[model samples]
Target: MKKIFSFLFLQFFVFSIVFCQNQKIDGHPAWIMQGNIYEVNIRQFTEEGTLNAFAKHLDRIKKMGVQTIWFMPINPISVVDRKGSLGSYYAVANYNTVNPEYGTMEDFKNVVKKIHKLGMKVIIDWVPNHTGCDHPWLDSHPDFFVKDSTGKPASMFDWTDTKQLNYKNSEMQDSMIAAMKYWIKKTDIDGYRVDVAWNISGNFWKKCIPQLKKIKNVFMLAEGDSSYLPKSGFDAVYPWHMFHVMEKIAKGTLNAWAIDSIRKQTEKRYPANTIQMYFTSNHDENSWNKADYETFPGAVHAPFAVLTQTMAKTVPLIYGGQEEPVLRPLKFFDKDPMEWGKYKRAKFYQTLLELRKRNIALAPNASFKKISVGNDKAVYAFVREKAGKKILVILNFSATEQNITIKDKTLHGTANNIFMGSTETLSSKKWKMEPWGYAVYEY
Candidate 1:
C-alpha cells in the first residue's frame, strides 16, 4: 500500500507539471498584446502583383508603425472551376506551394525575410475548411471531402471553385494540420489568419491548435465571430457585430449608444483574454460590400477608426490601400491595382498607431470606462487606464458641431492633446468639436 501511494503521487506530480506548461502555450503571445496588424492584398497592392514588388514598400509600411503584416493566401489557385482571370485567393489549389504568379517559393521566402528584418512579424491567411477542386486530395483521397448525390466532392455554399473538407475523417484532419505545419516550418511565419474558422468543427481546433503551438508560439486569428473560436484556442476573432454597427451608425440608422450594446454582448459571449480584430475594411468588405470610403464615407470614417484603435481587447487592422484611401471596389479575381495617391491618411494612422505603441493605457488588457458626454446620441467618449496611465478618447459622430462637457471632476488635469501636439488643461468646461471631430488625450 505504501509503494502504491508513492507511485500515484509521482504520477500526479508529473500531470501537474504538464498542465501548467500547456496553460502558458495556450495563452496568446505577449508581443501581440499591444501591436497592430496590416493586411496585404498582394494582387491589388502593386502593379507587378508579386512578392518581390511588394518588398520594396516594406520601409514605407514599417514607418507607418505596422507591427505585423498579414499576407492574403500565398498558395496556388485552382484552375478547375476558377472564378475569373486570376481567380479567388481563397480557392487554394496547393497548400505547400507558393503561387507562381505571385513569385516562386524562393521569392516568398525572401519577402518574409525582408519583413522580419524590418522588425515586423508575418502571418499568412490559411484556408482549412475547404480546398480548390484542382487540389490533389480530390483525386488521390476522395474520402477527404464531402460527397454529393453523384458521389463526387461537392462545393461549399455556391463557392463552385472550392470543395468542402471532410472534418469527420480523422486522416483528413491530420493532413490539414500537417499542411498548416509545413508553412511555419518552411517560411518561419509568426502565425496564421484562419479563413472560415467557424465552419470547421470545435474538435479539430481542439486537436490542431495545441499541436501548432508546440512547434512555435504562433498567434492565431480567426475570420469568424463564433465564441467557440476563442474557447477552442484562437487568440483573436472577427468583430462582425461591431463592424455592422459602425456602418449603421455612419448611415444615421443607429446612434452612438448602439456601440455600448455590442460591447456588452461581446463581454458576455467570449472568454477572458480573447482579443477581437477591429477594422473599417477587409478583403471581403472591399470586394463585395465596397471599401470604407463607401461604408464610412468622408469625415465619418475617422471617428470609427479612432474607436477601433483605442478600444479594449482590440488589435486594429488597416487594409491595404486604405492609406491611399482607395475608394472603389477592388476586383476579386482580376488585376485592378490601386492608384496610389499621396498617402492622404498616412499621418492620421501613424499618430494612432504610435500612441498605441507608447501608451500603456491603450494596452489590450487595460481598464475601460465609458464616459457620458453631453450628447450620448451623437458623441462617444471613453477612458482607458492601465498601470497608472490614462487616455481619454472623444469623437463627434454627427454632421453638426457638438458642444460637450466632461463631467468627471477626477479627469480635470494637465493632458497632452495627442493629435494637435499641444498640452492643455482639462477642466469641467464645455468643449466645441466640429463635425466628425476626434480628440485623444494622454494624462
Candidate 2:
C-alpha cells in the first residue's frame, strides 16, 4: 500500500510540471517574453505585388534583428462595395483563399517556409469584426451578419463597404475559429495580428485561444487598446495613448515630463507581461498623417527611437520602407511602390537593433527607471538594468546642443556609447550633448 501511494504521488508531481510548461499567459509562451517584431506590408513592399518579391527582402529584414514578421492581410479582397481601385485588405471575400494578386496558396506556403528557414516567425493580419459586402458567406449564410432595426443586415462604424459579423451566433464563432486553425495547419504560420480586436466578443477569443494552443503556441497582437483583450487571450495591444503623447511631444505641444506621466498611466492600466507595440509610423499614420518625417522632424527622431527601445513593456516596430526613409506616403488601394535609395538612417536603425540584442538591460520587460529630467524641457535621461547588465540612455530633443550633468550615482563610470561607437566615462559632473544627439551607454 505504501509503495503504490509513493508511485501515484510522483506521477502527479511530474504531470503538474509538464502542464505548467505548456500553459501560456497573455498569448505568449514563457520563452517569448524577450523578442522584437517587425511589420510587413506585402502589397506595397515591392513592385511585383507577390510573395516571391517580398521573400527576397527577408535577408535584409533579418539583418535588422527582427525575430518576427507581421504581414498584412493576404486573403482575397471583396469586390462589392469596394473602395478605390483595389479594395481594402480588411474586406475579406473568402476566409481561406489567398489573394491572387499577392500570390497563389503555394506561393504563400513558400514564403512561410522561407521565413522559418531564416529562423524567423510570421504572423498574418486577421480581420474578424467585418467582411466585405460581396463575401460569399452573405449569400450562403446570411445569419452570420448582424441585423438592424429595419430588419436588414447592419453595417457598423460607417464602413459602408463592409458588413459586420454577428458574434452572438455560435456557428459564426466556430467558423472564425476554424478559419484561424486552417492558417495554422496549412501555412504553419506563427500567429495573428487581430484587427479591431475590441469590437469582437471576448467570449469568442476565450473559446478560440485554447483550440489554437492545441495546434501550436501562438502570439496574438490586438490592434485595440482595451485591457480585457489581453486578459482574454492577446499577448500585446496597441499603445494608442502613448503614440499620441509622442506626436504631441514632437509637435512641441508637450514636454519630456509628459513622457513620464504616460509611462506611469500605462503601468497602472495593463498587466506587466503585456507587450506594447511601439512605432512612430504605421500604415494608417503614413497615409493619413503624412508619414514620420512630417510627424517627427529633424533632431527628434533618434531620441524617440531610443526611448521606444529602452522603455519598459515596449517592442519596436519598423514598417516597410522606413529604412529607405520613404518621404512620401504610399497610396492605399493603389499600386504605389516604394522607391528604395541610399539612406544614412538605415545604419542608425541597424546599430540600435544590434544594441538591443546584446544588452540585457534593453531587452523586453527589463527594469525601466527614470534617472533625471533636466531643467530644460528638451533633455530626458533614464537608466535600465537587468541581471548584471546596465545601460544609460540620454537624449537631447532640442535643435541646439545641451550641456547636462549625470547627477545620478547609478550612471557613474566608463561606458560604451552605442550611437557614436566609442567609450564615454561619466564622473557624476557635467556632460555635453550635440544637437539632436542621443547616447546609449553600457555600464
Best model per TM-score = 1
Worst 10 residues of 2 by lDDT: 25-34
Error of 2 at 319 (Å): 0.7
**lDDT scores for all predictions?**
0.91, 0.82
Q: After superposition, how far is residue 54 of candidate 2 from its true place, in Å?
A: 0.9
Q: Give lDDT tens digits, candidate 1, residues 1-443.
A: 99999999999999875564344322787668778999999999999999999998999999999999999999999999899998999999999999998999999989999998898889999999889979999889999999988988988778999999899999999999999999889998989999999999788999999999998778899999999999999999999999999999898899989999999999999997889999999999999997697988989899999999999989999998999889889999999998775899999999999999989889778999999877999999999999899999999888889998989987998999999999999998887999989999999
How many Å off is the CA of 129 in candidate 1?
Answer: 1.0
In TM-score terms, candidate 1 sits at: 0.94
Consecutive 10-residue window with the lowest summed lDDT within model 1: 17-26
Q: Kindly list the per-residue Cα lDDT of model 2 for residues 324-396, writing each as its tens digit.
A: 7887787877788886656457787888777777777776667877877354578878888889999888887
- Superposed by TM-score, candidate 2 places the C-alpha of residue 408 at a distance from the truth, in angstroms, of 1.6
Q: Which candidate number would show the highest lDDT if scored against the true structure? A: 1
Q: TM-scores of the models, in the given order?
A: 0.94, 0.92
Clash number for every model?
0, 0
lDDT of 2 at 337: 82
